[model samples]
Target: MMIDLSRDINLLTKFSIFSKFPLDHLEHLLNCCGAYYKSYEKNEIIYFQGDDINFLCIIISGSISIEKIDIFGNNTYMLDFYSGNFFGEQMILDTPSISPYTYKCSTKCKILCLPFHKKYSTNNCKNTCDCRLLFRENLLNQIAENNLLFINKLEVLSKKNIREKIMTFLINESEKCNSNKVQIPFSKSKFADYLGVNRSALMRVLSNMKNDGLIELNNKTFTILK
Candidate 1:
């Protein structure tokens, strides 16, 4: 989608990472960061695992998911990101490690990519740049948050059973929503994929959970009862 500069700045404000960022510095930040926008079609592969890439990416629209493929070609869903959310900070900061996950566009997507190079980022920045300090702070914050997010992903993926996976995910969601009633971000089948469980098995366990009064489920919404 072609978004005019004014509207683009407004939409950027909606992203959690950029919510507190000043609009007056938006355009300059893009310039200093070497930001350029690009679009991808549904199901397109954005960055394959092991590829050499070092650009921070922010979703301007649509969604993307980080997935991994095992040697046997089995796929595991790692995480999902929506509009305004960002990724790749860890990769950029930890440049020695090659990419460890496949980033795929789950829907038609638009994203702004900022290419960061150590040689060009500091020591001799161009004279015209004005948001250098703020931009560096942004990168530090993104890297810090991304590290915490990795830990959260590990906690959820470590569950041993479908029931355990569901419970872990639901409890985490509850903490985020600060309520017993929580809504998952994905549909049933996608949720099964996320938990690394067979779709049928997930549904069966969820059915049992509902009947056992452990939870109430209506579509993606669930309320913990016990």
Candidate 2:
């Protein structure tokens, strides 16, 4: 669907990347960099691994699951991105790049795509130069933070045991949410894939942990009790 520029620009403002941008500046940027809106159904592929990624994709609603498929057809879950989160920011360089992971809709989704190359090709007016600079700075900061998160993901994957892995992941989530009670973003199967564990084993470990009085589990929310 074609975006109603005026109405959607208001929606874009809700994202932190555009938090500092004035509405007029944002509107000008939107004009300079064409905007596209796309919707997908649950379990639909947004982009396959090795697909060209030429634009920044922001989640306007719902969530996306990122995973990699190996030659043997084994799948490894990488991460989940929710509304206001974006992908392809790292690929928005001078050269074209392919996605390393597949992006699939975890639910019905609405996304906005902005062509970064368009922004580069268009000369910025003096009035919007500050807006361009701010946006670049914001993009860089987001990229750095994303890198840190990948490193943290590596840490989680490095644990020696399933119990350790589960605790490590829950602890990280607790820290991120600043609460002892943390919500698990993915379903049990997806979470197991992320942890590189068998779903049955993961469930058994969680049950044991609860019985050990180490944690309290309530649906998707787990509270660190110990």
Candidate 3:
């Protein structure tokens, strides 16, 4: 659906990157960027691996997930892309690079795509030049953080045993929450998928851990006791 540009600008400004635009140039900036909204059903594939990516995509509502498939065709849950998070800045660069993961809408989704035009230069944006620079920095920061997270997950999953993997994963979750009591975000089955473990093995490990008093588990809620 075509939304009023002003209203759409208002929604965009809520994000940190868009908020960098000067108040006076914000509307003009949006006009120059060129954007449109797209809706999708739950479980619908948004982008298949190796597809050409060219535009910035922001989830206006609902959720998306990036699933990575290995050479053996084993699928691993990578990350969830939620509302307010933006991606695909790398696609804007002149160099060629393709998407490595399959993207699918985890729920009914509304996505906003902004064209990354090569013609648009900051030389023309003299008044909002600083804002544009800051916007670039924000994009780089996001990309760096995302890469770091994947590296961290690789470290977590490289553990040799299920108990080691589960405990490492929980400890990382604890760091995010800033507390020992951490809530698992996914249901048991999905949680197993995210952790790259067998569901039944995960259940048995949790039971053993609780019995050993290494941790306490109540459904999805876990408390790191010892």
Candidate 4:
């Protein structure tokens, strides 16, 4: 489906990287880059590892899971996407240019695909000259944000035990939502993978937290009582 440049500009601006660009520049980008709207059913694989690196996709709505599969066929969910986040851009930096993991739609999703220019087309002057610089700058900022996310995940992984890690993750998520009570946005199995622990272990950690008066678990929701 074709999207109107004017309408998409405002939605794109919600992304931090594109927020700095002028609306005209963004509109130029929308014109130059072919936009495709794709829909994925829940649990459907959007792209698999080793898929060709062709386009960068922006999540317009819904969530997706990025999973890393081991040789044993075990899968670990590495990350998730929401609206305003970009995915599949890491392919631009891969040496062999293969996707390192698989992206699956956790819910029904809509995404906008932006294909890279071939041979640096100068057909659209607005995009070729001015908007090109903005694109590069936006990419750089995205890289920085990704690096920060990596560091934060590493810090979480450094916790001494499951309890500490769960606590750290909960506190961080709470802060991000700007509230003490937080609802996990993923399934139990997915959340376990994100926490890098087994499902049972994660449950035990939550139980311990409740016993310690740190949090109250009601169904799937977590209320920080401390």
Compute each candidate's TM-score over C-alphas.
0.85, 0.91, 0.85, 0.84
What CA RMSD would candidate 3 show?
2.9
Task: Report RMSD (Å) for each prediction in the order shown.
Answer: 2.9, 2.2, 2.9, 2.7
For lDDT, candidate 2 versus 3, the one ahead is 2
Off by over 4 Å in 1: 1-3, 71-73, 90-94, 117-130
Give the per-residue lDDT of model 1 (tens digit) for 1-226: 3335676777776666664677777666665556778899999988898876667778888999888889999878977888867776654453553667899998999988877556236443553365556655666776677666667768878988788878888888888779999998878888888777789999999999999999999888999987
Clashing pairs in 2: none
The global C-alpha lDDT for each of the candidates, from Candidate 1 onward, is: 0.76, 0.83, 0.76, 0.77
Global local distance difference test of model 3: 0.76
lDDT of the structure predicted as candidate 1: 0.76
Q: Give the TM-score of candidate 4.
A: 0.84
Q: Is 1 or 3 the stronger prediction by TM-score?
A: 1
Model 2 scores a C-alpha lDDT of 0.83
Across 1-226, the per-residue lDDT of candidate 2 in tens digits comes to 7788667887889887788888888887776666678899999998899898877888999999989899999888888889988888645554557887899999999988877554345654442477777777777777777677677789989999999999998988889889999999878998898899999999999999999999999989999998
Residue pairs with clashing backbones, model 3: none
Off by over 4 Å in 2: 71-73, 94-96, 123-128
| Candidate 3 lDDT over residue span 98-190, tens digit each | 777888988999988766465335334543465556666666776776787677678778999989988898888898889999987668887
Kindly list the per-residue Cα lDDT of model 4 for residues 28-143, writing each as its tens digit. Answer: 77677665788889999878987876777888989988888899998777778787777777544434546778988989999888765552343555433877777767877887
- On TM-score, who's better, 1 or 2? 2
